[model samples]
Target: MTGVPTGWRNVLPHLDYDLPDDLPPQSSLSGGVKVNLPLELLRQSRSRAGTVEIPGEVLDQYRRYRPTSLWHARDFGEAVGARVPIYVKYEGANISGSHKLNTALAQAYYYRRAGVQEVVTGTGAGQWGTAIAAACAVFGLRCTVFMVGDSLRRKPYRGTIMRLLGATVHSSPSGLTEVAAGAREGASGNSLALAIGEAVEYAATRDRTAFVIGSGETYSILHQTVIGTEAIEQLAARHAEVDAVIGCVGAGSNFGGIAMPFFADAAEGAGPAPLLLAAESSTTPKLTRGVYAYDRTDATGFGPREAMYTVGSEFAIPPAHAAGLRFHGTAKLLSAMRHRDQIAATAVGQVEAMDAARLFAVHENVVPAPESGHALAAAARVATSGVSDREAHHVARRGILVCLSGHGYLDLAAYEEHLTERLRDESPDDDLIKLATTALSAVPIEGGHLRVP
Candidate 1:
């Protein structure tokens, strides 16, 4: 490992590491993954059928907004405690107000390089779609976004933004495709139904478009390391070292991405790895409470070998407030790490998560998305406990990292509902569990000592 970055060391205390002169390139040995096509193929004429680049202007625009802000939550500490130091990588400050762009930008870069003329994707709450649509606008590629109809009706600002950015935005169940047709036939009222899996499947089946997913276990996990890389630098600048790192996990992108590098460092004997903890909603506490199993993503008989802790099959999930965390399974890569006992997991109830968000807003002056409150609450719990004694100090000295994934502006309606007592507390019902177990039984390949079909 190279020495710590000088810029970071100046701000953080007791930091260590040699800072490399250049950022490391993506490793070919992709941790139990095989690249179906060399990354270079993304940019070659042979692969793209002759598209050359993402355009210099777009690259320049991205450079303006590329690297985002990181901060030590000093105020958060005052309320929680002084012992546990909390640092947050505030992706909420980004244009789309979330870390979705971290992966979206990379995917766009690859797709444009691959000569893909169009990008197709789906969004439940619209953050991912907004990020990708913005990236496509900059890259001069056409973007097609399928938004869950309910979210579209609720968050019109997102749709307006997509159009202004020059992308085609459609509310799913609009009868544009078979997925929409099926949804219409099924006919649920005012549903938040972008049909993410269906949208991705449609894009993948096309030769002209590259399918993009907002979040997945591994894909986003790979991109989120940038957060860890930056945080490590920022903490080093502060001359500080953290004992634990905590983040909320929906599809496992933000948490896995940021923690993996530290885990790698520990694996290399560089130092101790922070106790990595992933927080999920009790309604969909797949990681901490789920039985490990081989599973499918969309439950629709599509998706990869999504090996992870998930509530249901990908195609189907019980409705939950944290819209993004509704996926059926986790990323296979993150799941493996969990099995190896390299990370810890926890699940918080919806009201608790919401209360955490309110507390954070009152203290930190930022209204966090409900998804992010899970980690915030977890970190707060750890910080509140005394750390003066060795046993308690261990708890206090922990480093808490929150991936402020996105702002909750689009979700204000939900918040309003919460305040008005209009929203009912809901969770994974027994029927949902039965559905999930049934989906798990469909997978043929079995490993990791899990019960098989």
Candidate 2:
């Protein structure tokens, strides 16, 4: 094995599991159906004692899904005044058109092997739901998705796709309490709903279902390492080097996937460690602008409370155009990366992100999601700054990689709204930030359940 990077050794310490021998071969059942064993055993294994196995078929499917091509945006590089090369790993090309599928597939396979009857999750841009739905269909498992009300209304295609995949989808804030009722009444103004919070609550309350967030669970990040694993191969094939890696920070799954592998390489001194940059919505700047605090995923009704960054500890949030970014805080892995200064966080407003999307379509021929556009905007800002080319170059240096988390096909209406100037630009107000920080500043009482507003 290649030498592990120094930073990774320090960060991850001793490896939790060893790498396995050749992947297990796929098995065929009675009806000529192909079955994966290694992936199942590895995912379902509770021993955590050694390297696990994944069926060769699953690994083959993984290869087909990964090592997604990297693109050199010459025009974008020129537009951004960057003389160096800039490369982006366009993950939107995935089967579900988002990075969520990478984790969803693994989670589904693992859960199915573990005898999980169902999987529950929350989605923002609907990418996560679509991914989970597809995985569930592949594994013949049931999936229930809770979507923010605003997203369900604004992006019906997402819901339709989920249904088509045979998953049940629900809009939060529709019932269950007065808070939900009031929130539903106010939902038409913005598509964001109380679904994610409700989904988490539901999952936590259930015994047969496992709740998966777009971002959460460190194991999820481990699954995403496949992206980095593939990226290393792809970049090397191109005889190129990455100076940095950038991706939007909604739930941070995509960001973590690509960054962690490189981090592993850096830990072992395999090569130069690329800087990790995470872009978030200015309107929902959980890491860059928000403080470290305990905040519920949704505040419309009493819901499962998870520690996250918050804009308002008590105030329920209105929906924003970047539906995927309406969350209140950062994931533990992301928080750890930030606290260690291994990753830098930046905030981009809706307008700027939309503009970046437009530029991407025009110059790159791919329409990026608003969340991805946020990263594009950050890349643009960093590239265009008057900093020395080398300095700036290193920031988003040519060969820099960006995770195209998802496509905007389902979000065409959002594109239209943006084109028509119907989408408003917003950033967190100082008072709101201060209020949220104040509310989260006090440490939560351990083992005391949160009392959702």
Candidate 3:
């Protein structure tokens, strides 16, 4: 354990589960056969225990960049004419420039301890892949990243960085895997689900190789709690009360990381909880328009079926500049929280998100990743609305905390497209959404009681 503050340990056990129960069984399809997931990982995912001890070596490595800085965005707040103070937790200060590294290092350390020689995983915007690749290099392990085809083609720099870290990067839905090869036919864009399928397929056929996922799992969320733990302490030192905490959601790792600690306070009746908000891409509005149901975690149905808000594993989402928010489903725990009315979600189009990013850059002097811009967009929306009604006591002053999950130095092209108005603001039509729902209806769901079509 990396010396967590007092009372922080009390929040850990309740972070994932409110009650003790058996972990749900999940089925994975490989070689046209359905197989159960490994029980070891499943047990850890279901465990209610809050804290996972960080190994000494992992902690030593994290010392280089772990406690990210939280900045009070006074200038940005002034430009937005916000009546409240805005704080940005900048996770882009690290080498990989994203919060993904928080879990990547932890995962790599576990793989090295288990004697695994290689780790295979999927990446959408390439941040997770880059983070994991860097982590593997530090731990003297090999990494194979199956990057989403669209992202691989559009963000060549991300792939270059991963390669520079000594990781093998392949464009997913390519000819590398039989399943991806078949699925690539006539497909216009690549999704996180498709990349996951490719990674799982490759890992299943090899020995001493393990498939790791960047998000949508409890362990990933557990590894991410450091973000919230740090944020709480930082805010306490400033004597600030957070009215709301917002973050962009793909598989909900970052949002869950920051929000869960506050939720623990609410759960224990220790303090008033901050409003939890998730910002998502309008192109793939899983939280805003998706149905709560049991859906496969991967495109080819080669992973566990999670109870989440999904647009179907087979849904073909329109390409957006915020590639990191292109996943089909959210984390199961986040989905459950939304279902229980514990969180609120909203969708922002690429154009609006870009506009928010530009406004942030001009005032804050930091270029935010397009995915993180979604949270900025949401913050802007709240600021524009005065942010007073959301509070219970109707205080004279208000505070908003936005999780700037990553920097966008590698995403200059995306900003250029937005500035040039080449990026489309339109979302997929009703017909496309219906097509995705229809595909989801065909998949058989077993464990979850809720179904949406």
Candidate 4:
């Protein structure tokens, strides 16, 4: 097997276009200028380095579960009548039960170095909270998480896991912060965005506490490039030729982790580039049907404005079994890629995605996370599409790489709901989506950008 990568790939400078930097901070509810964050992280967000070396401490922690297994799903491919080989990169070996630990450890290390005592953040489905909680325990820092109220109710065990890891968890829309108070009266009563706003306000109002983001930030996505870089070496050792790389999109970091290297190679003309696909839930229409615009990054306008494909930061988030996929906007980098036609996105129905997870479990003896199930379902579609790319001028199918971002063992509650036929699909409102887009358009554009925002 190939070893872990010493450095994480950074595709920020190679995106073929420049992205806007954050504007001056608007005053938050705490009567502060902005959220207090680690200066190193803020610098990294603007860095154009092709590759940043992973600190020794972070590397040591990564080695414990770095080289995640990548197996050829021949049995599942045959069962699904695929014409190409299906390879799955399973990342469930990590203790966090998801790929989020990759960034959580890096952030915690940076925070601890910056002389920060405590970290505050938000979570969805509790994976990011659990990850940050464990990282804080390792780094000798305190963690506080504001999880979506709906997600906390459905996955109480996840919150329990975070608490067991020594984190203090709170349900969003609670009386913790004034931002959450606004959320309680707004359309986005309980959402990842609202929780982020609350976390930012709390951090800004408190001393020695910094607000850390779990996903959708530029630095967070850059830190996750290890997943894609390692997969590159593993595929080379196996001599596997890939035609497509697929992953489920929440705020986009999970998919970015596995596809950044491939996309970077394509931009550099290093070799043949595979088709990139983003799989998301139909309920979260950000990457699929949402309009690209400059929207507030967090709820209540406490964060910077970013150009992304968003269904408006104020839209009522639909409750889906895959809570991680309930976010209303895609990451800035991922939205940029989509705007440039560098990737394709497809929405999967709730029931259909769970069935795909069950099929994979029955055939491969592994239960994928509900979010990853969307990618698995997309892989099945690509394999059975019977369509060929004219650019390649050949009907030859090579392989499809699926990033199984996490495991479903801790998410049995969702599976139970699905098995009992209680899970159903929820569709987005066209008029409401249009309303959100229109409001974002009037937010006043800040800097130079492309067809993106």
Q: Estimate each model's TM-score.
A: 0.79, 0.80, 0.89, 0.93
> Could you give candidate 1's per-residue lDDT for residues 1-453 as a string of tens digits?
223111100100112221111112222221222112226422221221211233344345545554556677888777766566788777787777777876677677667776788888777667888989988876778898877776677678889888888888888665666545555333221333336645654665555676677676344555566667677767777777787787787677777757776776665576988778777777666775565665555423344444555554423444556766655566655665565556777677767677777777878888988788777877776666621211223364656667777788777876776677675555666555656565453222234255311
Top candidate (TM-score): 4
Instruction: Write down the lDDT that model 2 would get.
Output: 0.64
lDDT of 1: 0.62
Tens-place lDDT per residue, model 2, 318-364, is 56667777666666556645644567777788888888888888888
How far off is model 3, as Cα RMSD? 4.0
lDDT of 3 by residue, 360-384 (tens): 9999999999999999988877766
Q: Rate the local accuracy (lDDT) of all candidates.
A: 0.62, 0.64, 0.77, 0.82
Alpha carbon deviation, residue 151, candidate 2 (Å): 1.2
Per-residue alpha-carbon lDDT of model 4 for 1-453, expressed as tens digits? 899889888888786677644554344554662335678788777778888889999999999998889989998888778899999998888778999999999999999998888899888877899899999999999999988887788778888889999999988876878777666454444588888888787877777888888789888988888889988888889999888899999888889989999988877887877888888888887877787777777776867778788887878877787888888888888887787667778889878899889989999999988999998888888888732221222222788999999998888888999999999898887887877677554323334322322
| Top lDDT hit | 4
Ranking by lDDT: 4, 3, 2, 1
Model 1 ranges off by over 4 Å: 1-62, 81-83, 183-194, 204-207, 314-316, 385-396, 421-423, 439-453
Model 4 worst lDDT run, 10 consecutive residues = 387-396
